[model samples]
Target chain A: MSGHSTYEPKTGFERWLDTRLPIIRFMNDTALDFPTPKNLNYWWTFGGILALMLGIQIVTGIVLAMHYVPHVDYAFNSVERIRRDVNYGWLIQFMHANGASMFFLAVYVHIFRNLYYGSYKAPREVLWILGCVIYLLMIITAFMGYVLPWGQMSFHGAVVITNLIGALPVVGKSITTWLWGGFAVDDPTLNRFFSLHYLMPFVIAGVVILHIWALHVPGNNNPKGVDVKSKADTVPFHPYYTVKDGFAICVFLLMYATFVFYMPDVLGDAINYVKANPLVTPQHIVPEWYLLPFYAILRAVPNKLMGVILMFAAIAVLFILPWLDTSKVRSMRYRPTARLYLGIFFLACLVLGFCGANPPDQPILGHEPSGFMLLDADINSIVWLSRIGALYYFAYFLLVMPILGLTETPLPVPEGISEPVLSHPAAAPTGAAAAPEKRG
Target chain B: MSKMLRKGLALAALGLALIGGQAMAASEADEPRAPSGGWNFDGPFGKFDMAQLQRGYKVYREVCSACHAMDLMYFRNLGQKGGPFYDPKYPNPNDNPYVKSLAKDIQVKDIDNDTGDPVQRPATPADKFPAPFPNEPAARASNGGALPPDLSVISKAREGGPSYIYSLVGLGFNAPVPAGLTVPAGKYFNPYFVGDVSSAWHGKGPAPKGGFISMPPPLAPGKVTFDDKTPSTVQQQAKDVAAFLAWAAEPKQEERKAFGLGAMIYLFLLTVIVYFSYRRIWRNVSH
Candidate 1:
């Protein structure tokens, strides 16, 4: 989000280097002269927080890989050696492991912020897709990275996810076998996962560059969803957002550090501590908390193939979000009808996450509640309740969005980014409270 | 009235789903509780007690070491910083009297230097703890289809950690079987451990399933003598060994916490400066 670059090379070396590679000019344009929205709120800071997390993961991951051995027999012990024998190794492992969770947490906030402000509309579509692509890469990278520890959960989780691929028709078995490189989740799987786990971060960094480039092209979509009318709506990214984002990043790091130092195992599964055994599976097979919503979607459908498709389609739907949201108005601040449904959609996702974390065998409604059918399908036990959650999740995008856009009356919007803030001095305690400040 | 009805219906639906999910969640909360006490290292600020670690090592050597192998440990580790036998006089553990004597007691498999032939000799301080079993099959064969897991990271590897270990080795043995629960012919009762008790799985009553462990309760009232005049009771031994294992799991715990404190202090200061800087920069901007 910037005006034309006003950066001019001053020094001889800078001038010479600018002509050769324009690297200085590029950095100046993106970091210094870039015009971010002046009215951007605290939610806007997560984008910067995510970038910081990515850097932390990469640095700590490299150090961890130096000491980590990938052999199945030795993998668990090697990790122990890092924690015990290597100097400052426990800190590095905690940083890398907890770093992944922090990265996901910030990215989730970033995405929800986009959804709230309709940041994916029209001109910002490619930027949004590139972001979605980055999210996809992160999921893959984190999944592979989890397997390198060779814990029971790590091994079984890999087997379960790869086995999901086997749900595909015809050539699924061969593909699954090829993925595992043996009849079961074996030594070679761990080896390949470690290599890809190391490599995927660089790939993510490449896509992240593209994501930022696409973002800078359109400038930021403010909470008002109003385009910048004049230079008054914008400020240079360096002094304003740099300080703001930097502050948010430090706070975020502090929170992450608390978990790493005080209670590292709180977010992790205790079952994963045990070494992987092919003969035994954990009593409760669950994925990491971040993957719970998708896992719920996968289990919601009883059929294997359909479950896999729906889980993927849940993410794929994001690519078409701009179109799916048929509203002429961008911000949900004005669209009361959409906001109502969005609340339900948000709650549904949380419920899905809850369903995912718990075992499906637990009987719902205090007793065994079964045979609740929808669309000729039997909804059995607590798993069926997840279907209710998944239904709203899909419907929020496919049905409620398109229909609400056509029917709902939106509250009046501010004429510009500064309108609400300038209009009320004492009355407006927060920018969000004075939102939808309609013109008289 | 219609608008209010619609809103109420939405709220009801949301409430029902959430409550239903929580009910199911409550029923599945069956993780066995483990006892945790009497350790030098228990919290973020806690550190290992050197005397306890030494006693724990003695217990491990005399009793547990007969069956389990600590594959990741070197004899020299005994004299490393944060370990039981670490004496500052011996910068090299191989030269330390305690470590050297322990290493010399074991015969290590190696290659002859001059003849390039396979040979065996007394181990040096640098050597890893030798396995009691030659291979996986042999280990399983000796232990009735279950291989004794390596002790290197067992503290960190299990669900309840050292607390679970203490409970399993101390309170787990000789406990009366719960009502309606029968111990099958080659199995033993151990409430702290959840193992391959297919018997309980089939004949399930009030007794929880899969609560049997093999290896036949390795610790007793006075299995290993303590050097520092501490009681050699099973409970004391269990607590000591648990403390030692916690150190094994994360020896750098204290260092990590120390670094985190410094980093947190720096970050707090930086946040303060940046917060002020943000306000100053935004002062001129109208929006």
Candidate 2:
């Protein structure tokens, strides 16, 4: 059955086109002949789920764009109409909104999985870098989409962010004006944001294709640190992985359906219901949850330009992680000391994200102010937490892996495929004869 | 193999616990009740007794409906208690039949045509109160540069919200006279007024100051009687209308509160199940 030829080219033109494109052959080879490690487990499935979410977002976004009006006066009302009057418009809007949160949720898992398994090491560096690019594009797309509603949060957010650009030295004001297409964030700004928000998702879809292409070259990393050395150590991607990935996707969809149908606004902001008003401001400003950690870093620094640059650099730093960590082992399983520290580093990142979402606390009383000193005991607890987390974030790549590579002792290595005790246990003799060496 | 499964189970358990904790934290903060003057609503807050709301509903049904619209609120909402409309369940019920009879004349648009124009008919239970003008230009032309805004969602749209509405309604008392502006005993100046402020007639407006408000104080003491002996002051009426407007803006208030409660419970149970499932699935595995 596997060897049978299913296709027959009737015409010379069709055969010629097939040779040039080779689309079906490419899919079969990468998705079939690709040798995936047997011990990948569930965590590795998140990359495929993230890709599915990206597709969901692009399709829903295009449909929404067809009905959404971009003018400031009409944008708010248009959303209301979509909610109340259009055919199943509420479901579409809710899916697009919540799908964004889910996409981020999956990507976070994907990144953490990479970190735990050292998927960024060696030849897989390009895959990790492309993933970072996709992450950046996702951020831009979500931010632009947030402003298209022209609600109170959208209007104020646009103002706050556009003003940040004006903090630049020479042509700052002009740049902001050009961005707004006016003196302030008004009708023109909303229109342009609508256009770009509609455009960026498709751009992200393109980047995701590149991300998958990069992943295919090195294939996937698995739970075991050992590389595939024999047939038993690997499996073809066709029946095995195709079935596994398909099952994972179904389970993910069930979880997604719960949010889409039951609690659509679970991740939405309340203030967004109010139409745009230039004179008013929301009591607090926050970006979406996926942006929280970087936003925390941006707020951690006192200086505006420094904060902006540091926040960006924090993300860009991930691209260079392959070169930064000098460890020879590919997975944390082989590096016991580094594994514990990396787990703590991951926890710190989660904590930073939570802090960023909540309101920043005031500094405790009776403490001296510290100036630009990286470590200051007198600063607010939140500031300290952010600072420490930021330090660990850099240290994980800059110090821990390299130091462990030289000093730490690894566990006993497993022998070749057929030699492990469990794989090749000596058979017991018949009941009485099996006890021959018991006295010794 | 068992060790890998155990690690995966542990991670899933942790994620579920975190989600459950967040849901519990959020539901505690989302309880719904009457607004009790916090944030922007503090200081010299006006009263909005049931009787006053009844009167405001009267004024809305009668005088305002002549030229203004409230396309956001439903007629059935009038039956709800503690809102701008008189609650039928109030201890001393006002003459609702009289009010309802008067409101019967008002025509509201019930459906939209293929061209997206509202098809007008007598107001129904589910229909939002109709606007006085067909569109923005028509509203502006009729109201002398005062384009009456749609009252639907107005309470949520403004910064100070109901307070702003109340304050704006009661503006123009003890207002200072501008240079070249004429002084009248009862007229109020509106900033949005088309004519020059210098030549405009100044009067005792609803509150203290007025720049360009067009409409005069429509609610005077004794204009409408309250069954509960509450004073029918304009301030009281303003408060009632503001409260009513808040409800109009978020008609799903009750549903939101209920859903929040259910979600909290569901998350808690799911968390517990996930914890045990993790234990069960990983019992034989070493991490």
Candidate 3:
């Protein structure tokens, strides 16, 4: 479901294949000649960066699986062997472990970029929803992958998170028992987690194919956040974007390599190094950094069931984000008032992440003198702060968007992608050399 | 996209409120902040100091080893390629004379070759370090109901990190209880733990800054003698053991960093060239 292909086979064998299957033509059309928005900026490069990271993870993971033991008794020791005994096994293991963090880092930026530009609006809702689906899959896949290590954090993390599913009312207990394959997290649990962790990335890859397919249908959303009026607004996707994306990918990899090679353990929980024990519980169990925001949401509310609901709802709200943000204007850049709230929302998320990593009831501020009591509930400042953050998180998506979208005044619109390019002298060189060539 | 759809989505989200109830009181205390200084293996170029690790091993053997188990490490591990006692003359720990002697110092029970009965014998290079206690229950029972954690990965396991261990062993005992601080009966007041609660207070009260830890004062000045004639000051011993534990947690860290430095150079150069090629291609077009 792309635009008509302009490709014609040049040789006899190529012609025969083209007529028979057209697979080569599909790649040629999409990669070489597909029209893409020229105004797209460095933010759009994250899609390519993400694709690179996924490929890195898959390759490293395949090699690691060659040596990783998924059995509960052997899993922790096997990882140690990889670190100490295996060839450049250290590099491969570090790359895979740190790769998970890099993947999440890119995905977060990509998701937020879409939000800022209103890329999820209108015809792109299906694409956005598919992205959200991939995100959910990634989370599940990462969680399962974490468990396969079978260390203290891995085992206990599996116990704590899997137990959250038991908060469901009627069938929850049965589902939990069924999931564990017995009464509690045991050998069977580790085995299943390993199997699913390996399988989920492929499912994610499948959905990614659809996400890109959907993008090709409507083409890309640009910084302008407006539909392309003509071919003038677009250029062939290959040389232009490929070169830019390639450069961005390299820069991204440079950062990732620094982490993988030097500070491999920085992003990991220190407790995960200890082998799993059923009898002892860590003082505080934290999920990986990527899951912290939602973890904060879960802990914000006191009720177990309600906390679960809110945590799930935080993600659920993202699915309907397109409908919630009713603004006629697509980009938040042009909506001054909306920008303010979005900035606050960003900090709120960071604070939530910080709180999630720390003890909930730990005093955020200095301890007071002897008998200071204003509100008994306010004793734990950090927990109360997280609650406020959670409140704003929900209200931003469900409340603020609907009210602001219809009310805010958007700046004057550009007639086409070239409007600003042509008006500004510094950018005019590009418009003069480039826009007409595509527009023709 | 439509009014009904919007309402439906909102209602679904809004319905989350119906499940709202009170939160469980947070049962956590502030974790100790890791004391920061440059570690030998801190940067991209850092490597483990072999001599320091040897000293650390002495401290572990003399003090911490009584209660803690380092299950993953064998006596031979100390003489392996990246380990502290590793000698270039004998790269394989199994071939190292020092490791052989160390292994033979401990006895392990194994099935007898002829009689098929469990028998005790001196450990060889291949044997794992014997635990001080046979099982978890025995270990717990001997240690005032607190199981001294396994040391093989303790430097990597605890939140405040190996540096925190250094702080605890070297400086933790020096911290006096604040004027208002009142530690409970069973807990020892150490700055590195969750915090010592007051004897009269329930668990819900605000945790003091200097937290509760189970281990009594273990390391002290002149506690362990160093074979290399390094003075066994508490600070020196603490740092050495911390260094050794870091090595135990990930012995290949030195090699990893060395390779990283080279890889970083190659990648930075390759990426720079790729960046230039990107610019060259983009010169004809603009975005």
Query: Which ranges in model 3 have alpha carbons more than 4 Å from their true place?
Result: A368-376, A421-440, B1-38, B174-189, B200-216, B220-223
Which tens-of-lDDT digit does each residue in B33-142 have in candidate 1? 44454555767677788898888878887887877888778888777777788899988777899988878988878999999998989988989888888788999898
Model 1: reference contacts kept, as a fraction: 0.46
Residue B265 of model 2 has an lDDT of: 60
Cα distance off (Å), candidate 3, residue B209:
4.6
lDDT of candidates 1 onward, in order: 0.78, 0.62, 0.79
lDDT of 2 by residue, A5-73 (tens): 335556787678678885655666666766666656888878779878988998888878878889987
Cα deviation of B137, candidate 2, in Å: 17
What is the full ranking by TM-score, best candidate first?
1, 3, 2
Q: Sort every candidate by DockQ, greatest first.
A: 1, 3, 2
Clashing pairs in 1: A1-A219, A2-A35
Q: Any residue pairs clashing in model 3, and if so which? A: A302-B22, A302-B23, B195-B211, B195-B212, B196-B212
Write the residue-wise lDDT of candidate 3 on A224-289 in tens digits. Answer: 877787877787888888988887887888899899887788899887887898876665677899
TM-scores for all candidates: the values are 0.88, 0.63, 0.87
Q: Of the candidates shown, which would achieve the greatest TM-score relative to the real structure?
A: 1
Report the C-alpha lDDT of model 3 over B1-287, residue by residue, as the tens digit. 12332232123222212111111222333454334565776767677888889899889887888989888888888898888789899977889998888788888889999999999999988888888888889998998888888888788787666677887777776778655565666667776564434443444545454566778888888899898999888878888888889898888888888888888888788778878887787676555
DockQ of each: 0.29, 0.05, 0.29
* Highest lDDT scorer: 3
